[model samples]
Target chain A: MSTVVVLAPIIVANWPVITAVVGAAVGSLGFAVVRGEETSQQRGETTTREEIEIDNSEILTSDTGFEEEIVVQREGVRAIFSRDARGVLRVCMEGRGTSHAELRRWGQELIDRVTQQYAYHRIVTELKARNMTIVDEQVEEDHTVKIRVRSW
Target chain B: MAKEELEIEISPSGKVTARTLGVKGPRCLELADLLARIVGREESRTLTHEYYETERQVTDQVDLYGHR
Candidate 1:
Protein backbone atom coordinates (compact mmCIF):
# COMPACT_ATOMS: atom_id res chain seq x y z
CA MET A 1 0.00 0.00 0.00
CA SER A 2 1.23 3.49 -0.74
CA THR A 3 -0.73 5.74 1.60
CA VAL A 4 -3.88 5.43 3.71
CA VAL A 5 -2.78 4.33 7.15
CA VAL A 6 -4.99 6.29 9.48
CA LEU A 7 -7.83 3.92 10.03
CA ALA A 8 -9.76 2.16 12.82
CA PRO A 9 -11.81 -1.01 13.12
CA ILE A 10 -11.96 -2.63 16.53
CA ILE A 11 -15.29 -4.28 17.39
CA VAL A 12 -14.84 -6.38 20.42
CA ALA A 13 -16.98 -9.40 21.56
CA ASN A 14 -19.81 -8.19 19.42
CA TRP A 15 -22.46 -5.62 20.21
CA PRO A 16 -26.18 -6.17 20.16
CA VAL A 17 -25.61 -6.89 16.48
CA ILE A 18 -28.12 -5.48 14.07
CA THR A 19 -29.86 -4.13 17.15
CA ALA A 20 -33.23 -3.88 15.54
CA VAL A 21 -31.90 -3.91 11.99
CA VAL A 22 -29.19 -1.33 12.60
CA GLY A 23 -31.35 0.65 14.98
CA ALA A 24 -34.16 1.23 12.55
CA ALA A 25 -31.92 1.86 9.61
CA VAL A 26 -29.66 4.16 11.56
CA GLY A 27 -31.35 7.22 10.15
CA SER A 28 -30.35 6.36 6.62
CA LEU A 29 -26.78 5.95 7.73
CA GLY A 30 -24.18 7.51 5.51
CA PHE A 31 -20.61 6.37 5.25
CA ALA A 32 -18.54 8.48 7.60
CA VAL A 33 -15.70 6.98 5.63
CA VAL A 34 -15.55 6.18 1.98
CA ARG A 35 -13.24 5.48 -0.92
CA GLY A 36 -12.07 1.88 -1.16
CA GLU A 37 -12.28 0.64 2.40
CA GLU A 38 -14.22 -2.25 3.88
CA THR A 39 -13.33 -5.45 5.67
CA SER A 40 -15.19 -8.54 6.96
CA GLN A 41 -18.41 -8.80 5.04
CA GLN A 42 -20.14 -12.06 4.07
CA ARG A 43 -23.79 -11.16 3.85
CA GLY A 44 -23.20 -9.72 0.45
CA GLU A 45 -25.57 -8.76 -2.34
CA THR A 46 -27.71 -5.86 -3.53
CA THR A 47 -25.12 -4.80 -6.09
CA THR A 48 -21.42 -5.26 -5.43
CA ARG A 49 -19.32 -5.45 -2.30
CA GLU A 50 -17.02 -8.15 -1.05
CA GLU A 51 -16.28 -7.47 2.63
CA ILE A 52 -15.30 -5.08 5.43
CA GLU A 53 -16.32 -5.22 9.08
CA ILE A 54 -15.05 -2.75 11.63
CA ASP A 55 -17.22 -2.23 14.66
CA ASN A 56 -17.51 -0.15 17.80
CA SER A 57 -20.08 1.17 15.39
CA GLU A 58 -21.50 4.63 15.06
CA ILE A 59 -24.94 3.13 14.86
CA LEU A 60 -25.54 3.36 11.17
CA THR A 61 -27.20 0.53 9.31
CA SER A 62 -27.20 1.21 5.61
CA ASP A 63 -30.20 2.02 3.50
CA THR A 64 -27.63 2.69 0.80
CA GLY A 65 -26.73 6.04 2.30
CA PHE A 66 -23.02 5.64 2.90
CA GLU A 67 -22.90 2.38 1.07
CA GLU A 68 -23.14 0.21 4.15
CA GLU A 69 -22.87 -3.56 4.24
CA ILE A 70 -20.57 -4.95 6.90
CA VAL A 71 -20.89 -8.43 8.19
CA VAL A 72 -18.38 -11.08 9.06
CA GLN A 73 -20.93 -13.88 8.98
CA ARG A 74 -21.12 -13.77 12.77
CA GLU A 75 -18.45 -11.25 13.58
CA GLY A 76 -15.69 -13.77 14.20
CA VAL A 77 -13.04 -11.39 12.89
CA ARG A 78 -12.24 -7.69 12.93
CA ALA A 79 -8.84 -6.00 12.82
CA ILE A 80 -7.19 -3.11 10.99
CA PHE A 81 -3.78 -1.53 11.54
CA SER A 82 -1.71 -0.91 8.48
CA ARG A 83 1.40 0.76 7.07
CA ASP A 84 3.70 -1.20 4.85
CA ALA A 85 6.43 -0.38 2.34
CA ARG A 86 8.82 -0.99 5.21
CA GLY A 87 7.30 1.63 7.50
CA VAL A 88 6.20 -1.36 9.55
CA LEU A 89 3.23 -1.33 11.97
CA ARG A 90 0.96 -3.93 10.41
CA VAL A 91 -2.25 -5.54 11.54
CA CYS A 92 -4.63 -6.40 8.75
CA MET A 93 -7.46 -8.92 8.69
CA GLU A 94 -9.98 -9.52 5.97
CA GLY A 95 -13.37 -10.90 6.84
CA ARG A 96 -16.25 -12.86 5.30
CA GLY A 97 -16.33 -16.17 6.95
CA THR A 98 -13.00 -15.23 8.52
CA SER A 99 -10.58 -18.03 7.94
CA HIS A 100 -6.88 -18.40 7.28
CA ALA A 101 -5.97 -20.00 10.50
CA GLU A 102 -8.70 -17.91 12.06
CA LEU A 103 -7.31 -14.72 10.64
CA ARG A 104 -3.88 -15.78 11.64
CA ARG A 105 -5.13 -16.53 15.09
CA TRP A 106 -6.75 -13.14 15.40
CA GLY A 107 -3.63 -11.45 14.14
CA GLN A 108 -1.45 -13.18 16.62
CA GLU A 109 -3.72 -12.53 19.56
CA LEU A 110 -3.88 -8.87 18.71
CA ILE A 111 -0.14 -8.44 18.68
CA ASP A 112 0.43 -10.24 21.94
CA ARG A 113 -2.36 -8.37 23.64
CA VAL A 114 -1.20 -5.05 22.24
CA THR A 115 2.42 -5.54 23.14
CA GLN A 116 2.02 -6.51 26.76
CA GLN A 117 -0.68 -3.89 27.10
CA TYR A 118 1.54 -1.05 26.00
CA ALA A 119 4.72 -2.12 27.70
CA TYR A 120 5.07 0.55 30.35
CA HIS A 121 4.16 3.35 28.00
CA ARG A 122 6.75 5.65 26.42
CA ILE A 123 5.18 5.06 23.01
CA VAL A 124 5.72 1.37 23.37
CA THR A 125 9.35 1.66 24.29
CA GLU A 126 10.20 3.02 20.87
CA LEU A 127 8.96 0.45 18.38
CA LYS A 128 10.20 -2.84 19.68
CA ALA A 129 8.42 -5.88 18.30
CA ARG A 130 9.78 -9.04 16.78
CA ASN A 131 8.20 -12.43 16.21
CA MET A 132 5.56 -13.26 13.60
CA THR A 133 5.38 -14.53 10.06
CA ILE A 134 2.82 -16.06 7.67
CA VAL A 135 2.64 -13.67 4.78
CA ASP A 136 0.60 -15.69 2.34
CA GLU A 137 -2.40 -17.91 2.60
CA GLN A 138 -5.53 -17.18 0.58
CA VAL A 139 -7.86 -19.98 1.60
CA GLU A 140 -9.32 -20.03 -1.91
CA GLU A 141 -10.03 -16.30 -1.92
CA ASP A 142 -11.45 -13.22 -0.09
CA HIS A 143 -9.09 -13.77 2.85
CA THR A 144 -5.81 -12.07 2.00
CA VAL A 145 -2.78 -10.79 3.97
CA LYS A 146 0.94 -9.95 4.00
CA ILE A 147 3.01 -9.22 7.16
CA ARG A 148 6.57 -8.28 8.23
CA VAL A 149 8.41 -5.72 10.42
CA ARG A 150 11.92 -4.99 11.67
CA SER A 151 14.35 -2.27 12.75
CA TRP A 152 17.69 -1.73 14.49
CA MET B 1 26.16 -9.53 26.02
CA ALA B 2 23.82 -7.32 24.02
CA LYS B 3 20.10 -7.29 24.52
CA GLU B 4 17.27 -4.85 23.72
CA GLU B 5 16.03 -5.80 20.32
CA LEU B 6 12.37 -5.95 19.31
CA GLU B 7 10.80 -7.63 16.31
CA ILE B 8 7.15 -8.55 16.09
CA GLU B 9 5.57 -10.06 13.03
CA ILE B 10 2.08 -11.53 12.77
CA SER B 11 0.94 -12.47 9.34
CA PRO B 12 -1.13 -15.23 7.79
CA SER B 13 -3.55 -12.60 6.72
CA GLY B 14 -4.00 -10.35 9.70
CA LYS B 15 -1.05 -7.98 9.44
CA VAL B 16 1.19 -6.39 12.09
CA THR B 17 4.94 -6.00 12.14
CA ALA B 18 6.83 -3.99 14.75
CA ARG B 19 10.63 -4.04 14.65
CA THR B 20 12.73 -2.13 17.07
CA LEU B 21 16.09 -2.85 18.51
CA GLY B 22 18.35 -1.12 21.00
CA VAL B 23 15.93 1.74 20.41
CA LYS B 24 16.69 4.61 18.10
CA GLY B 25 15.85 8.27 17.48
CA PRO B 26 13.81 9.72 20.33
CA ARG B 27 12.69 6.16 20.83
CA CYS B 28 11.35 5.89 17.29
CA LEU B 29 8.03 7.63 17.79
CA GLU B 30 8.15 6.13 21.22
CA LEU B 31 8.15 2.86 19.38
CA ALA B 32 5.70 3.61 16.60
CA ASP B 33 3.36 5.43 18.96
CA LEU B 34 2.54 2.51 21.17
CA LEU B 35 1.89 0.35 18.16
CA ALA B 36 -0.46 2.99 16.83
CA ARG B 37 -2.69 2.74 19.85
CA ILE B 38 -3.13 -0.96 19.37
CA VAL B 39 -4.60 -1.61 15.91
CA GLY B 40 -7.53 0.67 16.63
CA ARG B 41 -6.84 2.41 13.31
CA GLU B 42 -3.87 3.46 11.32
CA GLU B 43 -3.73 2.76 7.62
CA SER B 44 -0.35 4.27 6.89
CA ARG B 45 2.73 6.00 8.32
CA THR B 46 6.44 6.10 7.54
CA LEU B 47 9.59 7.09 9.38
CA THR B 48 12.57 4.96 10.14
CA HIS B 49 16.30 5.26 10.57
CA GLU B 50 15.02 5.18 14.04
CA TYR B 51 12.10 7.16 12.71
CA TYR B 52 14.44 9.89 11.56
CA GLU B 53 15.97 9.81 14.96
CA THR B 54 12.93 11.33 16.61
CA GLU B 55 13.87 14.00 19.09
CA ARG B 56 10.33 14.28 20.28
CA GLN B 57 6.95 13.57 18.70
CA VAL B 58 5.27 12.07 21.72
CA THR B 59 2.43 10.63 19.65
CA ASP B 60 -0.86 12.44 19.96
CA GLN B 61 -3.61 11.90 17.44
CA VAL B 62 -6.39 10.98 19.78
CA ASP B 63 -10.02 11.82 19.10
CA LEU B 64 -11.13 8.24 18.58
CA TYR B 65 -12.62 8.40 22.04
CA GLY B 66 -15.39 5.77 22.22
CA HIS B 67 -14.52 4.35 18.78
CA ARG B 68 -17.69 5.12 16.87
Candidate 2:
Protein backbone atom coordinates (compact mmCIF):
# COMPACT_ATOMS: atom_id res chain seq x y z
CA MET A 1 0.00 0.00 0.00
CA SER A 2 1.33 3.44 -0.87
CA THR A 3 -0.80 5.33 1.61
CA VAL A 4 -2.12 3.73 4.81
CA VAL A 5 -4.54 5.37 7.19
CA VAL A 6 -6.31 4.53 10.45
CA LEU A 7 -9.87 5.77 10.81
CA ALA A 8 -11.47 6.60 14.12
CA PRO A 9 -15.21 6.20 13.83
CA ILE A 10 -17.32 9.33 14.08
CA ILE A 11 -20.83 8.29 15.08
CA VAL A 12 -23.28 10.38 13.02
CA ALA A 13 -26.58 8.81 12.05
CA ASN A 14 -30.31 9.06 12.51
CA TRP A 15 -32.37 6.52 14.45
CA PRO A 16 -33.22 4.33 11.50
CA VAL A 17 -29.65 3.95 10.26
CA ILE A 18 -28.39 3.36 13.74
CA THR A 19 -31.06 0.75 14.39
CA ALA A 20 -30.31 -1.13 11.18
CA VAL A 21 -26.61 -1.25 11.92
CA VAL A 22 -27.16 -2.23 15.51
CA GLY A 23 -29.38 -5.11 14.39
CA ALA A 24 -26.80 -6.30 11.90
CA ALA A 25 -24.02 -6.07 14.42
CA VAL A 26 -26.07 -7.91 16.98
CA GLY A 27 -26.76 -10.72 14.55
CA SER A 28 -23.12 -10.93 13.50
CA LEU A 29 -22.05 -11.17 17.12
CA GLY A 30 -24.54 -13.96 17.89
CA PHE A 31 -26.68 -11.90 20.22
CA ALA A 32 -30.44 -12.25 20.34
CA VAL A 33 -32.60 -9.14 20.70
CA VAL A 34 -35.21 -9.24 23.44
CA ARG A 35 -38.13 -6.86 23.44
CA GLY A 36 -39.24 -4.67 26.33
CA GLU A 37 -39.62 -6.60 29.55
CA GLU A 38 -40.31 -5.53 33.07
CA THR A 39 -37.17 -4.77 35.04
CA SER A 40 -38.96 -4.05 38.31
CA GLN A 41 -40.93 -6.16 40.73
CA GLN A 42 -44.75 -6.13 40.30
CA ARG A 43 -47.64 -5.95 42.77
CA GLY A 44 -46.16 -3.18 44.89
CA GLU A 45 -43.24 -5.27 45.95
CA THR A 46 -39.98 -3.68 47.14
CA THR A 47 -37.15 -5.55 45.44
CA THR A 48 -33.90 -3.87 44.43
CA ARG A 49 -32.41 -4.89 41.12
CA GLU A 50 -29.17 -3.76 39.49
CA GLU A 51 -30.45 -3.88 35.93
CA ILE A 52 -28.54 -1.43 33.71
CA GLU A 53 -30.47 0.45 31.01
CA ILE A 54 -28.96 2.20 27.97
CA ASP A 55 -31.13 5.26 27.66
CA ASN A 56 -29.29 8.62 27.30
CA SER A 57 -32.24 10.80 26.33
CA GLU A 58 -32.08 12.84 29.48
CA ILE A 59 -29.34 14.97 27.88
CA LEU A 60 -30.99 15.27 24.48
CA THR A 61 -32.84 18.22 23.00
CA SER A 62 -36.22 18.41 21.20
CA ASP A 63 -35.01 18.10 17.63
CA THR A 64 -34.07 14.43 17.92
CA GLY A 65 -37.11 12.14 18.03
CA PHE A 66 -38.12 10.17 21.07
CA GLU A 67 -35.36 7.78 22.12
CA GLU A 68 -35.78 4.08 21.37
CA GLU A 69 -33.94 1.47 23.42
CA ILE A 70 -32.91 -2.02 22.32
CA VAL A 71 -31.71 -4.74 24.63
CA VAL A 72 -29.68 -7.73 23.51
CA GLN A 73 -28.70 -10.57 25.77
CA ARG A 74 -26.14 -13.33 25.33
CA GLU A 75 -24.85 -15.55 28.12
CA GLY A 76 -24.19 -13.31 31.10
CA VAL A 77 -23.63 -10.14 29.11
CA ARG A 78 -26.27 -7.58 28.24
CA ALA A 79 -25.78 -4.76 25.72
CA ILE A 80 -28.06 -1.78 25.47
CA PHE A 81 -27.90 0.30 22.29
CA SER A 82 -29.73 3.59 21.98
CA ARG A 83 -29.56 6.98 20.27
CA ASP A 84 -29.37 10.24 22.12
CA ALA A 85 -31.20 13.48 21.33
CA ARG A 86 -28.31 14.65 19.15
CA GLY A 87 -28.59 11.55 16.95
CA VAL A 88 -25.53 9.78 18.29
CA LEU A 89 -25.71 6.05 18.94
CA ARG A 90 -24.37 4.79 22.25
CA VAL A 91 -23.83 1.25 23.50
CA CYS A 92 -23.66 0.29 27.12
CA MET A 93 -22.56 -3.20 28.12
CA GLU A 94 -23.18 -4.81 31.48
CA GLY A 95 -22.22 -8.26 32.63
CA ARG A 96 -23.84 -10.23 35.39
CA GLY A 97 -21.21 -12.93 35.80
CA THR A 98 -18.35 -11.74 33.63
CA SER A 99 -15.25 -9.70 34.31
CA HIS A 100 -14.84 -6.05 33.38
CA ALA A 101 -12.31 -6.80 30.63
CA GLU A 102 -14.65 -9.28 29.01
CA LEU A 103 -17.46 -6.76 28.97
CA ARG A 104 -15.21 -4.12 27.44
CA ARG A 105 -14.03 -6.52 24.77
CA TRP A 106 -17.59 -7.43 23.82
CA GLY A 107 -18.51 -3.75 23.65
CA GLN A 108 -15.52 -3.04 21.41
CA GLU A 109 -16.45 -5.86 19.09
CA LEU A 110 -19.98 -4.51 18.72
CA ILE A 111 -18.66 -1.04 17.97
CA ASP A 112 -16.22 -2.36 15.39
CA ARG A 113 -18.90 -4.36 13.61
CA VAL A 114 -21.22 -1.36 13.44
CA THR A 115 -18.46 0.91 12.21
CA GLN A 116 -17.33 -1.53 9.56
CA GLN A 117 -20.83 -1.97 8.18
CA TYR A 118 -21.42 1.77 8.17
CA ALA A 119 -18.08 2.55 6.57
CA TYR A 120 -18.55 -0.04 3.84
CA HIS A 121 -21.88 1.46 2.80
CA ARG A 122 -20.66 5.03 3.03
CA ILE A 123 -17.46 4.34 1.11
CA VAL A 124 -19.24 2.59 -1.73
CA THR A 125 -21.78 5.40 -2.06
CA GLU A 126 -19.17 8.15 -1.92
CA LEU A 127 -16.86 6.48 -4.40
CA LYS A 128 -19.68 5.85 -6.86
CA ALA A 129 -20.64 9.51 -6.54
CA ARG A 130 -17.05 10.44 -7.46
CA ASN A 131 -17.49 8.47 -10.71
CA MET A 132 -15.20 5.62 -9.82
CA THR A 133 -16.01 2.14 -11.03
CA ILE A 134 -15.63 -0.69 -8.58
CA VAL A 135 -13.60 -3.43 -10.21
CA ASP A 136 -13.53 -5.99 -7.41
CA GLU A 137 -14.44 -6.42 -3.80
CA GLN A 138 -13.39 -9.00 -1.19
CA VAL A 139 -13.97 -9.59 2.46
CA GLU A 140 -10.95 -10.86 4.33
CA GLU A 141 -10.99 -13.62 6.91
CA ASP A 142 -10.83 -11.01 9.63
CA HIS A 143 -13.85 -9.27 8.07
CA THR A 144 -11.93 -6.36 6.55
CA VAL A 145 -13.00 -5.30 3.07
CA LYS A 146 -10.68 -4.75 0.11
CA ILE A 147 -12.04 -2.91 -2.91
CA ARG A 148 -10.29 -2.27 -6.20
CA VAL A 149 -11.51 0.61 -8.33
CA ARG A 150 -10.59 2.39 -11.52
CA SER A 151 -10.87 6.17 -11.81
CA TRP A 152 -10.33 6.47 -15.56
CA MET B 1 -1.72 0.81 -22.82
CA ALA B 2 -1.64 0.74 -19.02
CA LYS B 3 -4.52 1.94 -16.83
CA GLU B 4 -4.39 3.69 -13.49
CA GLU B 5 -5.58 1.55 -10.56
CA LEU B 6 -6.28 2.42 -6.96
CA GLU B 7 -6.41 -0.41 -4.42
CA ILE B 8 -8.27 0.50 -1.27
CA GLU B 9 -8.01 -1.62 1.88
CA ILE B 10 -10.51 -0.96 4.62
CA SER B 11 -9.51 -2.76 7.78
CA PRO B 12 -11.99 -4.35 10.12
CA SER B 13 -11.15 -1.59 12.55
CA GLY B 14 -12.18 1.06 9.98
CA LYS B 15 -8.68 2.10 8.80
CA VAL B 16 -8.21 2.82 5.08
CA THR B 17 -5.10 2.54 2.90
CA ALA B 18 -4.99 3.41 -0.78
CA ARG B 19 -2.25 2.31 -3.16
CA THR B 20 -2.05 3.89 -6.55
CA LEU B 21 -0.64 1.94 -9.47
CA GLY B 22 0.39 3.34 -12.89
CA VAL B 23 -0.08 6.90 -11.68
CA LYS B 24 2.84 9.18 -10.92
CA GLY B 25 3.76 12.62 -9.51
CA PRO B 26 1.04 14.93 -8.20
CA ARG B 27 -1.69 12.72 -9.58
CA CYS B 28 -0.86 10.18 -6.89
CA LEU B 29 -1.67 12.76 -4.24
CA GLU B 30 -4.94 13.47 -5.95
CA LEU B 31 -5.85 9.79 -5.88
CA ALA B 32 -4.89 9.53 -2.23
CA ASP B 33 -6.97 12.57 -1.38
CA LEU B 34 -9.94 11.11 -3.20
CA LEU B 35 -9.66 7.84 -1.31
CA ALA B 36 -9.16 9.59 2.00
CA ARG B 37 -12.22 11.74 1.48
CA ILE B 38 -14.24 8.64 0.71
CA VAL B 39 -12.86 6.81 3.75
CA GLY B 40 -12.10 9.22 6.59
CA ARG B 41 -9.40 11.56 7.90
CA GLU B 42 -5.86 11.46 6.54
CA GLU B 43 -3.55 10.04 9.18
CA SER B 44 -0.17 9.85 7.38
CA ARG B 45 1.19 9.23 3.90
CA THR B 46 4.41 7.71 2.59
CA LEU B 47 5.52 8.63 -0.88
CA THR B 48 6.79 5.77 -3.04
CA HIS B 49 9.27 5.79 -5.91
CA GLU B 50 6.33 5.83 -8.30
CA TYR B 51 5.17 8.94 -6.49
CA TYR B 52 8.45 10.66 -7.40
CA GLU B 53 8.29 9.48 -11.03
CA THR B 54 7.52 12.47 -13.20
CA GLU B 55 5.52 12.62 -16.38
CA ARG B 56 8.63 13.67 -18.34
CA GLN B 57 11.11 11.11 -17.01
CA VAL B 58 12.02 7.52 -17.93
CA THR B 59 13.72 6.45 -14.70
CA ASP B 60 13.05 2.96 -13.30
CA GLN B 61 15.23 2.87 -10.18
CA VAL B 62 13.15 2.23 -7.07
CA ASP B 63 13.48 4.82 -4.26
CA LEU B 64 11.98 3.48 -1.02
CA TYR B 65 12.68 6.06 1.70
CA GLY B 66 10.17 8.83 1.16
CA HIS B 67 7.64 9.60 3.91
CA ARG B 68 5.81 12.70 5.09
For DockQ, the strongest prediction is: 2
State the DockQ, from 0 to 1, for candidate 1. Answer: 0.11
Worst 10 residues of 2 chain A by lDDT: A51-60
Q: DockQ of every model listed?
A: 0.11, 0.41
Q: TM-score of candidate 1 restricted to chain B?
A: 0.28
Q: A36-119 in candidate 2: lDDT tens per residue?
A: 653223334443223222222122333456447677777756677765555456676766566667777788777677677766
lDDT of 2 by residue, B1-62 (tens): 45778777777766666778777787888877765655556777887777665843533333
Q: After superposition, how far is residue A90 of candidate 2 from its true place, in Å?
A: 2.3
Off by over 4 Å in 2: A1-7, A32-68, A84-88, B55-68
Residue-level lDDT for A73 in candidate 1? 19
What lDDT tens digits, residue by residue, belong to model 1 across residues A2-63?
A: 11123233322112332222232212222121125444343442222222222232332334
Q: Name the lDDT value of residue A106 in candidate 1.
A: 55
